[model samples]
Target: MEENRGIWVFIEVTDGKVEGVSLELLGAGRKLADKLEVPLAGVLLGHDVRKISAKVIEYGADIVYMADHAVLELYRTEAFMKAVVAMAEKYKPEIFLYGATPNGKDLASAVATDLSTGLTADTTMLDVDPEKRLLEASRPAFGGNIMATILCKKHRPQMATVRPKVMKALEPDASRKGEVIEEEIHLEESEMRTKVLQIVKETTKTANLAEAHVIVAGGKGMGDKNGFMLIHELAKTIGATVGGTRDVVEAGWLPHDQQIGQTGETVTPKIYFAIGISGAIQHVVGMKNSELIIAINKDPDAPIFDVATYGLVGDAFEIVPQLIEKFKELIKEKGGEISYV
Candidate 1:
């Protein structure tokens, strides 16, 4: 373990820009590195990724390990895993963090398997013990009822896959300078199992709840489909996105993509409205990290209020309508057009 030193974050890139989760992990890695008194580094993979190494440094990494190759242009489990594992084996990092995206999970799993090390998945919280040099990775466990902190005691490099939007990225400073080390790995087209034939992006309005500043979410307490319309009405008035609890999705009030809970998308919006939600543990685990949680429910003892900044104990039916009207009036005063009808 003497060879392993710095903390490394996998900088996942898509199209051209670096993924938000990668930057977030860099911010997180910065803190861990400071505590452990080690350098914070970023592992960047893909063709034409040299320029991205600068952005990674600006985001808090002290060093950037870049691998640029034709075969690495697209994300394939085989080519990416080979390059990443090679880098890990050559220049050992004491701690490695990857975003819990589709590609991230696949790559992390394969690398962990090859290295014979522990890899925690979907981690929500992260901390480190400088004394033991243990990377404490915490996540919702037992169906979101309890938080289990995982530690890789016997592993040389502690690895974790953190969910996107769960961590915040540092403000990039272009003035900050760092080192960029170029790495190379041999990859053959025939050896790879999957090929990137075409990249077709979704044309529909994707549910970007993770990035929404304000979200109005409902639950089964919303009664029926028509009752759920009130949620949409308020969301439209405030120019916010509409989300739902697991029960609402099961009831066909919203699609599964719009659900916010342990089994759904985790969100950390600036302001979150929990309308007609009972605040089950599964639901709270997803949105408890929101900057400002405003819960509206008739039950005073509801669990959601435990983490909410403001608790409105009243019927969402009565309060939501009045709230919509107030927002409309406020928008009008600000010279903005808003219609509740």
Candidate 2:
């Protein structure tokens, strides 16, 4: 229970490496830490995961509380929840933030239930009330029409789960140091219910849309698969990733990973191309946060132009090919090392 009062981020590790969402949570946690004038801590739970805490330190953690046990090797909903609940019982942190992953949400919900504490889910933003000692968690509600901020006013360890890719991770600073506290995990392997049979990772034969800085995304306006083909050409020429709207993904023009909307992946690429898409509130809410949006649609009355930084009233089939040709020529002339990130 010593030195436990602070903002804490739940660190997620897969195959002994920290997840990007974990680092992103740390970055968000640092802001709350500064606001509260308390240390920003990272809570790492796993079996023999000592090597992971150093990376947490680089991502702006002022302290890391680690719980290593053989029973914690793989994620079990009950075991992890118990371990985390035990940690919470001891330290009593003012604020705790979790990534909105399947495992994260599962563990968080269970822990909140056990502790009889308040918990908010899929928060897009977080802030602290210095006067009330409250954690304000805001998330999109009812198809992104309204944003609701929830409060856990009475809970000692106020908790919220935030969506992935919604927050930015801080640049790693090797010089910025922190503290690591090793804890003894009291769970036995015999008490576990589920066992991990096997782990199969999904393979997509395309660029990681979430990681791409320059994303050329098409929506239903792309018309057909052929329309998406033109999008692919431009994206390939400029070394950008391809993404689509929910309509296109449902139509099988692209995979689910390439989907960029409310039910799909949230993106903030430097340049986003909305080809042939009539911007719906559902779609726009996701990519409206992009740095620069360029919309290409035949309909001048398309709702996409409202949020687009640049609007092109043209057919994507005709325009995308020209854009591809131009980009290839420009890159050929310049040659080598053009990064959109």
Candidate 3:
């Protein structure tokens, strides 16, 4: 723990830009680093990623440990893991965080095996003990019924993978100054077991519920597939994206991509409408950071109301149609088009 003194967030870059989750992790890392009075660093690995590395500093990284190599451009598990392990061994950070992204999870699992370190996945909360220098990684346990805080007291670098949108990022400051440590990676193509043939990105509009400004989400209380139409109707009138709970997805009322919960996408929408959701911790962790939360359900004691900024104890079936009509009239008067397709 003495040698491992800094906080490090793995920077995720795609299409020549830093991912939002990585920036958010930097913000979270900044707070932890400040609490521990340690340097906050970002690990940036990619070909010609120095430009992106500088941006990580602007996002609150006090130091950026960068490894730029041809094999690092595309995120193959083998190449990224090798580079990251090399950096971890050399510098030795106290806390290492990665976005719970596909690439991040893959690399973390592989590297954890090699490094013989404990990795807490899908961590929703993080804290550090300045006295003991322990990273308290808290995550949902028992099927999201409770919370668990994991401590890597014996480990050097306590690692965790955090879901996207679960953390907030600081405002970028172009004037922010930081140090850039360029590390050489001696990885070759022959060492890699996988290659990026073609990156097929999902371009569907609803693929990213996390980026939506307004979200209208339903839950099992929605009852049936037909009953869930009210969610879409209301979302259409308000120009908001549609989302559902894990139960709604399991019932085949919506696609898995639209689910908002621990096992699904995490979002921090400006306005979130929780229609018929019972406010489970599993679902709340994904969207508790919403700027405005409005919950409507027949049960007044439903847990969803606990986190809701505004709560209406009424049947969503009865209330949603009225909401849709009202918004439709309002949008018509304002000449604004609905966002729902």
Candidate 4:
């Protein structure tokens, strides 16, 4: 355990570009490393991904462990797992962080099993006990009612998978410099059990709430499907994206893709309008990071008020319609054209 000394973030590269979540993790890991007084390192693996090492350092990594190989062109579990495991055994980082994307989750789980270390999945918050040198990985637990912080007291490399959009990435610094250590992969394609067939991308059109600049998210307090129409009306009028709570999705008022909560997608918009939301921790965890949170609910003491920048204690039906009209008038004043994004 004493041999493990630095913080490591797995930099996921796709189509010759680093993933946003990887950059976010690098920003987060940098803080932990600074507090622990250890170097922040990034583990980069993929074919032709050497160019991304510089970006990783600009994001906050002091060192990048890169492995560039043809077999790693696509994300194959066997190939990635072997490469990461070998790096872990050699470098021995005190803490390891991965994005909660599909590929990241798969790789982290495999690596944790092989390394026999404890891992916390879907972590929304991360902290460290500098004295004890423990990673405090917290996430919604027991149906998202409360947050539970998991710790790996006995493990050498405390690993965690953090949800995307929950953490903010630091601004890039091109002038920042870091050391890139290239590692040679000893495994070949013949030794791998799984082979990449063909990749298929989703072509469906859906509400991209994660990337939306302004989001109007409603909860069950909106009454029903008809009441939910107000959410869409306000969103369309303002050119903002529409999102719903889990209850709204379960009631078939909105599609699952538009649900915002712990069990759904996490979002960080420039402005978030939480209408008729009671603000359960589950729901708050997804949108608490919004730059401006304006919550409207009938309950004067709704938990949403706790984290909201502005709280409206009234019926959303009356408040939202008035707001919609106000926005429409404002848009009409500006040549009937408004862009929120």
Instruction: Score each candidate by Cα lDDT.
Output: 0.91, 0.86, 0.89, 0.92
lDDT of 1: 0.91
lDDT of 2: 0.86
Q: Give a tens-digit lDDT track for model 4, residues 163-278.
A: 88777799999999899999998878889888878887764324378778899999999999999999999999999999989999999999889888888878888999999999
What does candidate 3's lDDT look like per residue over 1-341, in tens digits?
Answer: 57778999999999898989999999999999999999999999999988887799989999999999998889998889989999999888888999999999999899888888889998989888888888899988898898899888787789999978778899999999999999988988887878888988785645658679899999988889998998988877787899999899999999888988777877888899999999888899888999999999999999999999999999887888888888878888877775534
RMSD of 2: 2.9
Q: Against the true structure, whose lDDT is highest?
A: 4
- In model 4, which regions exceed 4 Å deviation? 203-207
Q: For all the candidates, what are their Cα RMSDs to the real structure?
A: 2.2, 2.9, 2.0, 1.6
Off by over 4 Å in 1: 203-205, 338-341
Model 1 TM-score, all chains together: 0.94
TM for candidate 2 is 0.89
- Candidate order, lDDT descending: 4, 1, 3, 2
What lDDT would candidate 4 get against the real structure? 0.92
Per-candidate TM equals: 0.94, 0.89, 0.93, 0.95
> Model 2 misses residue 98 by how many Å?
0.5
RMSD from true fold, candidate 1 = 2.2
> In model 2, which regions exceed 4 Å deviation?
1-4, 205-207, 268-270, 288-292, 298-303, 306-309, 313-318, 336-341
